[model samples]
Target: MVDPSQAGMVAVGAGLAVGLAGIGAGLGEQAIGAAAVGAMAEDEKFFGKGLLMTVIPESIVIFGLVVSLILLFVF
Candidate 1:
């Protein structure tokens, strides 16, 4: 059986992990997205690469979600 205090701590840790990751990803994407848009505006050919670059930061959120799941269920 999990101790109540320990469980609470673990939950908080998991929440922080996901929340911080999301915030970081959002900040990264904000800059990348703006740059991508600017590049796309300058050259239509930049659309594909710019889109890929802008989407890359979203992987951080997925990683964070995995970590949170592990903490919640594996600990």
Candidate 2:
């Protein structure tokens, strides 16, 4: 009992949510990753902090995927 137009719109929205989030995550990570590498290059002890910072942006993608999944099932 799903309307085709509604379903298509939901699908498009889900795709956009996931794709844009992924792109944003990638861009966010790129800057952080560069800075992390630079810091690590300057000091060996910065590795742990750098790694943690580098990974933090990955949560954006996870959130986007969760939203996309919810949209896929909820609608």
Query: Which model scores highest in lDDT?
Result: 1
Q: Write the per-residue lDDT of candidate 1 for residues 1-75, one digit (tens) a residue.
A: 568779999999999999999999999999999999999999999999999999899999999999999999988
Q: How accurate is candidate 1 locally (lDDT)?
A: 0.95
User: CA lDDT of 33 in candidate 1?
Assistant: 96
Q: Against the hidden reference, what TM-scores do the models get?
A: 0.94, 0.93
Please give the RMSD to the true structure for each candidate, in Å. 1.1, 1.2
Residue 34 CA displacement from its true place in model 1, Å? 0.5
RMSD of 2: 1.2
> Where does candidate 2 clash, by residue pair?
none
Clashing pairs in 1: none
* Candidate 2 runs further than 4 Å off: none
For residue 1, model 1's alpha carbon misses the true position, in angstroms, by 6.3
Cα displacement (angstroms), candidate 1, residue 38, comes to 0.4
How far is 3's C-alpha from truth in model 1 (Å)?
2.4
Error of 2 at 33 (Å): 0.4
